[model samples]
Target chain A: GIQVEQSPPDLILQEGANSTLRCNFSDSVNNLQWFHQNPWGQLINLFYIPSGTKQNGRLSATTVATERYSLLYISSSQTTDSGVYFCAVNGFSGGYNKLIFGAGTRLAVHP
Target chain B: EPEVTQTPSHQVTQMGQEVILRCVPISNHLYFYWYRQILGQKVEFLVSFYNNEISEKSEIFDDQFSVERPDGSNFTLKIRSTKLEDSAMYFCASRTRRTSNEKLFFGSGTQLSVL
Candidate 1:
């Protein structure tokens, strides 16, 4: 099984601030996805980048497959962005068949 | 857009009682999964079902746990006998079978509290 590790277990930011969250995996991943768990406990798929960079609204993500790492960037953050961000990965082996999640990075955006 | 939906947003049950969590996955998705998260803990995978049978499952999904795709739209996770530790947020997810990769659509989740 591949291990997914996310950094900065907790973060607090004021509105308009920016932050970057990182995830590292122990093995090669066939696919990688990022999710935001809002205050209401709804997991929204933010990014599905197996490799390369992508952006949506105020959020962007980049996955360096060769390095086994990925990053999620929140730009000019708003209070609505407050929630837990999760990075999940599926490796090239049997472990890659199912997505395994990280411990999550909890973000609190204060107005 | 179409999304996964779960019923009984919150549930409180007694230990040792049978409880079934229901979900309606995206109409076109082929892979279904059940996951749980204890408060302040990492989300854990329980089981994965495909083709009307379980394809893989974690150790946490033991004898007491079972999954069923009883119909075209409904997927269910049944816990035969619950335990106090079972109290957590349960999430249901589904993904379509794309040739390369697919993103999973997750339901809002069920907050189950076992007493």
Candidate 2:
């Protein structure tokens, strides 16, 4: 079993501001995903970066598998981005592909 | 794009009653999973189905919980007897491949409210 811990726990940002959320895991992982849980509670997949860095519009994520940590960056944040961000991971052995999610980072963007 | 779709956005049932949550995963995907999130809590993995059999499951998925891919398109989870504690948002997710680093597309989720 792996434990995933998210940083800040919560965050508040103003429109156009940028922020970074982090996730650290206790054991080795073969998969890592970042998700945004909107106000309506829909878990939307943002990134599936097991390693390396990836960008999608204003969102970007980088994972250093060697250190067992990942970082999610939101640039020029918007009100619509206000929600909970989660990081999930899976191991190479047991629990592989079966996700274990972090508590999440509650983000509130004020207009 | 073909995304996961769940039925009955919400479900309400009495304790001791049976309830089935239905999900239509992406047509081309082979792996299906069920995860439950108690309100304001973390998402807990219930089970993972692949090749028409359960590949893994958590302790929470007891005798009361079962999963079936009755048809090629739909995956269903059945709870023999619903309990108040069972009330939560159950999400259905699927991935095109069973390999690591693959993205799992999840549905809006079925909000089960057991009374």
Candidate 3:
């Protein structure tokens, strides 16, 4: 089993500020995803980046698979962005891949 | 977009009682999974189902827990005897492809509270 670690266990940012969240896995992964668990407890898919960089609106993510690390960037943050951000990876297991989640980074974007 | 749907958004059950949580995964999805998140804890994987059978399960899934795709469209998780620790937000997820790179779509979740 692969161990997933997320940094900055807790973060508080003012609206319009920028922040970066990092995730590091112990082993190589074939798939990785970023999720936002909103205040309502719905896990919203942010990005499924196995490698390279991808941008979606004010949110973007970069995964350096060789380095076994991924970074999620949030720019011009808003109050709506307040929630727990999670990073999950699909590491090989029993001839298949299982999604393993990391302890989320709780972000509070105050206006 | 198609989404996974879960029933009884919140449930309250007495300890030792049998409880069943239901979900309807995306119609085209071939892989289905159940994950749980205890309050203030990380989301944990419980089981994954494909080809109408379980493909992989975590230690969290024990003899008291079981999963079934009773019908072509409905997926369910059953607990023979619920315990106080069983209370958590249970999520149902689905993915269209069996490959590793495919993204997963998760249902809102069922908040089960065992007393």
Model 2 regions more than 4 Å off: none
Question: What's candidate 1's DockQ score?
Answer: 0.55
Whole-model Cα lDDT of every candidate shown, in order: 0.90, 0.93, 0.94
Off by over 4 Å in 1: B98-100
DockQ of every candidate: 0.55, 0.67, 0.69
lDDT of 3 by residue, A69-109 (tens): 99999999999999999999987554446688999999999
Q: Tens digits of per-residue lDDT for model 1 on A31-103?
A: 8999999888778889999999999999999999999999999999999999999999887777326788999
Q: Cα miss at B41, model 2 (Å)?
A: 0.6
The Cα error of candidate 3 at residue B17, in Å, is 1.3
Higher-ranked by lDDT: 2 or 3: 3
Q: Is candidate 1 or candidate 3 better by DockQ?
A: 3
DockQ rank order: 3, 2, 1
Q: Clash number for every model?
A: 1, 0, 0
Top lDDT model: 3
Docking class of 2: medium
